[model samples]
Target: MAEESTKSWADTDSESSSSSSSSSDSEQEEVHYLIDDQTSDDEVFDFSNIEFTREDLVQALNDMVHEYKTLSHTFEEIKAENASLKNSSAKSSSDELEDTDSLKIELSKLRIENELLRSESSELKAEVEKLTK
Candidate 1:
C-alpha cells in the first residue's frame, strides 16, 4: 500500500509540473502577440492584467535611465562634431574668397601695364616713320 501511494504521488507531481509549464508557454505566446500588434496613437496601453513584483519594476526603470544617459552622451558628441565641421567649412570658404580677391587685383594690374606698353610702342613707330621719310 505504501508503494502504491508513492507511485500516485509521483504521478500527481509530474502532472502538475506539466500543466504549469503549458500555462507558462501560453502566457508567453499572449505577451508576444500583444507586442506584435500595432496600435493607433490615441490608444493607451493596458497593464492591469500583467503581474510584476516591485523589484522587477524598479529594475526596468533603472535600465531605462541608464539607456537615456547613454543616448544623451552620444547626442552631445554628435553636436560637437557638427560644430567643428561647420567651423572648418567656414574657414575654408574665407580663404577661397581671399585668394579670389588677390587674383582679381593681379589681373587688373596686368591690364594697366599692357596699355602702357602699347602706347610706348605706338610712339616709337611714329618716330621711325618720320625719320624714314
Candidate 2:
C-alpha cells in the first residue's frame, strides 16, 4: 500500500509540464464559481480593504522622526548642563584648597612670632634677677 502511494505521488510529478498545460487548457474552458451563495461572473479582486495608506504611513514616520530629533536635542542639553556643573564644582574645590593653604601659612608665621616673644621674656627675667642681687 505504501509502495502504491509512493508510485501515485511519483506519477503525479513525472510530467509536471504536461499537467500544467492541461490545467491551463481546462482554465480556458470557462467554469462557473460561486461567492456567498451568489454567482459572481467577474472576479472583482479588490485591495481597498486595508486601512493604512502610503500617505498615512509616511506621515506617521515623519512624526516619529521629529519626536526622535527633539529627544536627542533634550539629551544634548542635559549633558551640557551636567558638564558645566561638574566643571564649576571642580573650580570651587580648587579655590577652597587655595584658601586652606593661605590659612596654614598664616598660622605658621604666628607660631614663629610666639616663639620669639617667649625667648625675649626669658632674657628679661634673667636681667631683673641679676639687678635684684
Candidate 3:
C-alpha cells in the first residue's frame, strides 16, 4: 500500500509539471498576441495625431515658392555670368589668333632678311679672294 501511494505521488508530480509547462507556454503566446495588438493600435493612434492645419500647409507652400523664386533668380544670374565669360573668352582667343598671325609675318620677314645678308657675305668673300689671287 505504501508503494502504491509513492507511485501515485510520483504520477501526480509529473502531471503537474507538464500542466505547468503547457500553462506557461499558453501565457507567453497570449502576451505576444497582446503586444502585437497594442503595437498596431499605437501606430494607428500615432498617425491620427499627425494632422496638418490649413495655415501650416499654406506657410509651407509659400516658403517653397519663395525658395523657388530665389533659386530661379540665382540660376538666371549664373547664366548671364556664363554668357559674359564666354564672350570674354572668345574675344581673348581672337586677340591671341591675331597676335600669332602678326608674329608669323614678322618671322617670315626676318628669315628673308637673314638669307639676303648671308648671300651678300658670300659674294664679298669671293670678290676678296679673286683680288688677292
Candidate 4:
C-alpha cells in the first residue's frame, strides 16, 4: 500500500510539470501574437483629422472653466436665496406670535364687557320689580 501511494504521488508531480511547461509555451506564443497585433493596429489609426494647435485646446478648456464658474455662481445664489427665505420665515413667525398675543388681549377685554352687561341686566330687573309693586 505504501509503495503504491509513492508511485501515485510521483506520477502526479510529473504530470503537473508537463502541464505547466505546455501552458508556459502557449502563454509565450500569445504574448508574441499580441505584440504583432498592436503594431498592426497602430498602423490603422486615422491621423488626418487630428488638430495640432495648442490654442484651440486652450480655448476649449477656458470655455469649460467659464461654464463651471457660472454654475458655481448659480449655486451660491441659490444658497443665498435659501438663507433669505429662512430669514423671512423667522420674521413671519415673530409676527404671528404678536398677532396671537393681540388676540388674547382682545379675548380678555370681551370677557370683562360680558360681566358688566350681566350686572347691568340684574339691576334693571330689580328696578322693574319695584315699580310693579
Residue range 54-76, candidate 2, lDDT tens digits = 44545555677799999999999
After TM-score superposition, the amount by which residue 16's alpha carbon in candidate 1 deviates from its true location, in angstroms, is: 35
The segments of candidate 1 whose C-alpha lies over 4 angstroms from its true place after superposition are: 1-46
Which numbered prediction scores highest in TM-score against the true structure? 3
Candidate 2 colliding pairs, count: 0
Q: Backbone collision count in every prediction?
A: 0, 0, 0, 0
True-structure RMSD, every candidate: 15.3, 18.2, 23.5, 19.2
Q: How do the residues 1-133 of candidate 4 rate in per-residue lDDT, one tens digit apiece? A: 3455556667966876777777878876886676566655564322233553434445555677799999999999999999999999999999999999999999999999999999999999999999999
Instruction: Give the Cα-based TM-score of candidate 2 against the true structure.
Output: 0.53
Q: TM-score for model 3?
A: 0.60
Q: What is the per-residue lDDT of model 1 for residues 29-120, given as tens digits with 9 covering 90 to 100?
A: 89768765746463343333466544444555567779999999999999999999999999999999999999999999999999999999
Lowest summed lDDT window (length 10), candidate 1: 40-49
TM-score (C-alpha, index-matched) for candidate 4: 0.54
Model 2 is weakest, by summed lDDT over 10 consecutive residues, at 30-39
Which residue pairs does candidate 2 place in steric collision? none
Q: What is the lDDT of residue 29 in candidate 3?
A: 82
Deviation in angstroms for 39 in model 2? 41
